[model samples]
Target chain A: MRKTVLVVEDEFLIAMDLKLLLERHGWWVLGPAASVEEALALMDEELPAVAILDVTLRDGTVSLVAEALRAEDIPFVVASAYDKPEHVGGEILAGAPNVGKPTDQRLLLAALEQAIYRMNGTSLPLDP
Target chain B: MNLEDLYRLMRNGHVQAQGIIDTVPEPLLVLDQNLCVQTASRSFFSTFKVDRDETIGQHLYELGDRQWDIPELRLLLEDVIPKSKAVVDYEVEHDFPGLGRRTMLVSAHRLFHPDNISRSLLLSIVDATKRREHEAEKDVLLGELRHRMRNLLALVQAMARQTTAAGRSGEEYRDAFLGRFNALVQAHDVAFSHNGAADLQQVVERTVAPYSGSPAGVIVEPGPTVPLASGQIMSLSLILHELATNAIKYGALSVATGQVRLRWEIEEASAPRLRLVWQESGGPPVAAPASSGFGTQLIEFAAKRELGGRVELNYAPAGLMVEIVAPLASVS
Candidate 1:
């Protein structure tokens, strides 16, 4: 089965743009859910192979969602305007992969792929 | 008078003076000409956390490891007090023992007694520590607010660049970008009016009020008031503005007799949620557009991403109806 990815971002244009970009990459997208609650709702119905989350939302931070994803053994990357990990959560999110907002599409994809492989205990294939 | 009688009188006078100092509410002190502490009020001992043995008969600077050794304070006591015969409202900020940094207003006056030749000074202190800290905190909050505003402007700048890059004509790009910017402004206005938390009804009313045409033109059935955070308010305002702009240009609001009804309700579930409806009627026949435009995409994306809700836009023959269902916490 093709890998599925969940996207949780609050910015409307950014979310739409990311959705289109991810879809073009041959991954089934679960959601571009805006808030933590909505992201959790999507997770309850089905767990995506990987996820992308914004650090801040309308209601609160997405640390809870990140914690939940961690608990489920699902890999996820932070895509947010906040550059420093301390702004999100210092030690708790220290090792997780992240892509800053106004992000380069290529960088985001690379991070997502890295997270997936890291979770699966594998390494990316060397370029021919 | 005999020397014994003079000694008895001086002792009695000192006892009476100590009694008066103990009754003062403000932190007060009685000091001799040499700036040695003769007495301190009960308030002074508790406020500065100094004990009786640590203060009385000691040089002021020697008390509490020289916490009172402030250079400015020394000037006021040794220089200003003597030349002026009194120092009023002398301000000093210092790190006192046990207490952190404190701002204090010190006032002193030379005491006079007809029967005595020596000079004693009465000093009073007003602690402004809490007030200063509160002001400092307000400054920090204001700075953070400014930083957020600058970031918002930067986001707008990026959006403008992207919109132009998407191959829009000059007029089309200007109109679309300005519409979005104004929507953001409306959101900020509402958020600021309510101190960063705006009521949902108020936000809706503010967005559509301009297009209402007349008093009954847009019927806003009051709904349960929901407090939305600054970010939520901005996103909702953008969505509503987009919908209203569409209504006026192509939907129900185009005609004079057109009407738009707005209302919302709380969905009591495992977690409470908000359900809003925007229904329009008495206008041109409606049909779904051939393709989704930027406006439509914004509404759908915001409802899904910003509010954690579902958006359903039905273009019926009669008019257009939009339903939004999202978690209350997300929207508010």
Candidate 2:
């Protein structure tokens, strides 16, 4: 079975690119949600095995979404445009593995694999 | 001692006390129980553009064309100061005759003499206008800089990831990325230069400039002035760039007789909308692509997702036509 991953981003091009990138890596991609309300709504419907989040969204900062993910004990990675993750989301995102914007495909995939491994104690195979 | 004796003592010490107050730098005033100015420092006269002759012994509220007659100040001196003994840093904003508008932090200290009947208040004024203005200006500048930098980086990253490298050589991929990067740079310049919004015509002209040299080149019809927000301008510029690139590669601009005409209008309805039309004519027979490419997806995403709009791409034997309709609120 393919691993499921939630992708949260606001920018249309970036979101679409992420959807394609994750799909290419053999992961079942959930919504590239545009806002906090949308992200929470998606989670209400179905929870992904892991999640990737942008620190800022169209509606506001991703703190509420981060807290919700933490409450569910779901592992996630930060893919932010900000230089410092703590600056925008405060302590809620203090230690998350951040794959900064204009992401290196290698670094992003590596971070996601690490996050999933840390959570489940097993790593899922991805397409080279 | 009687009130007369108190007045004699004050008169005797007036010059020496005035000298000491003058050296204090900031504006200072001594007001009697009646709120009448008993004496003022030299700095007070210079700061307020007032002279000692007309200021001393005058009612505090009645000085400088009655500029000092502020309700907040009245409340502080008449009610608050008397009860509190000292009112520190009471903010008062008022328009003075020569100084225009200024924010002042007024501190008043009640001085009780040995004689219970005689009382005076020490008032000091510190201008806080420049400090407050500077703080507000710095905050706006920093926020704008951070937002612009992050957005620019994200845009470049998206282009890098999406630019297809499947069949093309390294140079081809670099050119494609640089082409989109240039469009983003120009869009950013146009958006920020006009204070977070750009003219629609300017965006169109700049995006299509490189492809305009082709025969029967691109013609932009004059339309009503439309201003788009920074985000809208960036998205629209990228969409135009993709369209122009496609046209030059295989569509209208590839042939000498081919031409492209761009026009737009504001559709009036319950909610006004902007309708932009890009029509290519006199090119080789047109047909829809075998499969959707990166350009096609970019144009679709930029229109439908970013602008919250609808896009219609029509492939006709004569030419290709693309129409985009977005809410006026979203674009502006």
Candidate 3:
């Protein structure tokens, strides 16, 4: 089964790039949601196996989405450009594994795998 | 002492006390037990825009249309100061008649004269408005800087990741990345130079400068000044950069005699919209690309998503023309 990953980013180019990058890595990409409302709306339909979130969005911080994901016990990683992710996302994002922007693909993928492993006790295989 | 001598001594003491308060600099007021103004410093009279005659012998609360009758001031004088003997840096915010809204640090000390039986309160007012304003401004600037820094890094990261390396040498990839990076930097510099908004003409001129080495290669028609918000400026700058880069590679700027004309005007409607046109002429015969590349996608994304606008790309055999229209509300 293909594991789905939710991508939340506001910038158009960044969102497009992340979507393309994650898809190329063989994970089923759920969204490049531009705002918290959009992200939550996407989740209402289906929860992804894991998620990657940008701290700031056009509408507001991604705290609401983070809270929703936490409530569901879905594993997630932060891909942010913020110097301090916790300062912006507050307690909800205080300890989330952050793959800071200009992210190395290796590190981002590794962190995502770690989050999945921590949650499910086994990593999902990347699709060939 | 004789009666006349005693009165003379008291009057001299009052004059000396007034002179001492006058030299203390910050606005000072001496209030009796009833909170009536006993005497005020020269600074107080000048600072509050009141004469000594109108200020002295009047209730402190009744001064200047009763602007001084602040609840915080009453609490400080009637409740806090009596128990504490001295109250320092008690903040009171009030709108004064001529001075507008101001923040003041009101410090008061209960005064006791050894020979005199009467008690007074020494109140000093420090205008803290400018200091508070500066602090607020600093906070705004820092937040803006942080926000811009994060966005800028994300943009650069996106550019790096999306700049395709397929069918290109390592050197070619470096050139492409650097070109886009330089454009981003230039756009940021221009956008932030004018207090968070950039003029449209300047953005166009700066973006096309590298490709418009020849005098007539890129013609930017002088248009009415259109100011763009920071986000719009960044999007427009990158769009222009991508167009210019494509032009230099295969369009107008590729040939010595080719030219590009950039023009913009405000369209009058219920909501004013800014219309910008980029036309390439006298270039190699134009043909629509077989596939949409990074440049095309970037231009589309920037116009539609970033600027909240629509873009049309026309590949005329004579030249390539692109028209972009965005709401004025988003521009400025």
Residue ranges of candidate 1 with Cα displaced over 4 Å: A1-5, A10-17, A24-27, A33-50, A56-61, A64-76, A81-83, A95-98, A101-128, B1-147, B150-167, B197-201, B213-232, B253-284, B301-311, B323-332
Residue B230's C-alpha lDDT in candidate 2?
87
TM-score of each: 0.58, 0.69, 0.67
User: Among the candidates, what TM-score does chain A have in each?
Assistant: 0.89, 0.95, 0.96
Runs of candidate 2 with Cα error greater than 4 angstroms are: B1-147
What fraction of native interface contacts is shared by candidate 3? 0.62
**Per-residue alpha-carbon lDDT of candidate 1 for residues B127-234, written as tens digits (9 for 90 to 100):** 977877899999778856664664465456544644443666878889878877877778888898878987888888888878786534678898887889887887
Q: What is the DockQ (computed on Cα atoms) for candidate 3?
A: 0.43
TM-score of chain A of 1: 0.89
First chain TM-score, candidate 2: 0.95
Give the range of the ten consecutive residues with the poorest summed lDDT in model 1 chain A: A83-92
Q: lDDT score of model 2?
A: 0.89
Pairs clashing in candidate 1? A34-B305, B228-B332
- Please identify which of the two predictions, 1 or 3, would achieve the higher DockQ against the true structure: 3
Better of 1 and 2 by lDDT: 2
